[model samples]
Target: MKRFSLNQATTRHWPMPDLVAGCVRAGVTGVGLWRENVQEYGVERSAALVRDAGLTVTSLCRGGFFQEPTWWDENRRAIDEAAALGAGTLVLVSGGLPPGSRDIDAARAHVGTAIGTLVPYALEAGVRLAIEPLHPMFSSDRCVVSTLKQALDLAAPYPHRAVGVAIDTYHLWWDDTVWEQIARAGREQRIACFQVADWLTPLPAGVLLGRGLPGTGCVELRRFREAVDAAGYAGPIEVEVFAEDVWSRPGDEVLAEALAGYRDHVAGPG
Candidate 1:
């Protein structure tokens, strides 16, 4: 059976119970959560709430932002939190280019160094690290990892070694090299995670990360699924829509609509 996981951002205003409840209402079997929510609700209780509702936590996002010289302590704590949630993959958003640095190469180096530093800690915690590649537009401020290929390239040396890429369509949809990269990540055993939401226009500056429901935008859903599955991936297809507009509505409505959109756009015609 195919499983869907609720991305915590979809119900940003709700408590963890409410978020997991929304997923239950939508018939989704899994949930992917951000660290802030865990901090707010407390990991043990949050994990209990989801499990009580019978939800599978696909991943715990995230554990990066290594630009700070003193960030390791905080990141290690995040790994411990993921362990509490029983989430196997801890997504990492290698944060932005540091100030006074026009050089993207320097930022990329930071990401590599950060991951190399964190991988062992994660493995010891029995959790994997998934490096998420943000869109190129976010290169200067949000995440330095920008392509599945780029992320795979970085983690290739560490294959099956508890570090890999988080395959999110919102960031990689426009990449001309997606197919090749997905194949490479698969062959190399590097697809640590998978997620989706569509891309829309006129996105507010801070919410450029806000993505539309899957199948509503330009992503070729069936082809995307085929490529991932072809590479032998059968993980949860996490719904990670981050729209401010959607969040303003009632949580149940947003979840129902996102699930319906996924069904109509992805599971229906194709």
Candidate 2:
């Protein structure tokens, strides 16, 4: 229960103030935030709001997209925002190949080098860059770091406290070797965060908003929780769903349902 965190995406349209209140009322002490919303509501003000509500900012949604022209400046700003919000982790979504280019290996190499360039700033700002490997389905457009192994490899050159991997159930659930990789991540102290979003079939057109709630899809939610716990990770377990149906509902109602799902499927006997 202490590890449970409400990823703001679960209630995508919820206003920042309302989201904070809902989390408090639902006994949620941690939250994973997105950059746009924080910027819209004002980063310092939002940070103050969460602090006043006694909530912890577990991890900020994103700080990577190396393919973009303005990636360096954008990521630097992201790290500053996370630091301002008191979030120790800044999740990185390594962007895909550059436009009109088919060099995937080159794109991956660029991501690693890009992260290296940001290490000094990350360490100065006291934020750990948590590289998140999105699903292979997004490999062409969203992310090239499509496996936990690849993410860990990219983070290996830096100090674990400065660079780590973000483990998400939706992306890694299909891999048979994930358990071993989780163990390896723990051994290297490279696990910076953990996110949960069940996998549903017949993905939507963009495939970005197809995630289901815990216990509402095929992923073994408890298995992932147990595996991470076994690997000595006791960080926030963020429930991040990106579904039109989930977001269409009232934010409070969604928060309640998410908490229930966490208790049933993710908060099993330790």
Top TM-score: which candidate number? 2
- Give TM-scores for every candidate, taking all chains together and pairing residue i with residue i: 0.94, 0.98
Error of 1 at 74 (Å): 1.8
Summing lDDT over every window of 10 consecutive residues in candidate 1, give the lowest-scoring window.
201-210
Give residue 37's error in model 1 in angstroms: 0.9
Candidate 1 per-residue C-alpha lDDT over 1-270 given as tens digits, one digit per residue, 9 for 90 to 100: 256677887778878888887777767888899999988888899889888888888999888877766679988988898888888888988888787788888888778877788878888999888999988888877788888877887786664658988998888888889999999888888887888788777565766756888766777766776788888788888878787887888989888887887677655557
Q: What would the per-residue lDDT of candidate 2 be over residues 147-251, giving only the tens digit for each residue?
A: 999999999999999999999999999999899999999999998999999988877775798899888888999999998888989989999999999999999
Q: Which pairs in model 1 have colliding backbones?
A: none
Instruction: Assess candidate 2 and give its TM-score to the true structure.
Output: 0.98
Error of 1 at 84 (Å): 0.5
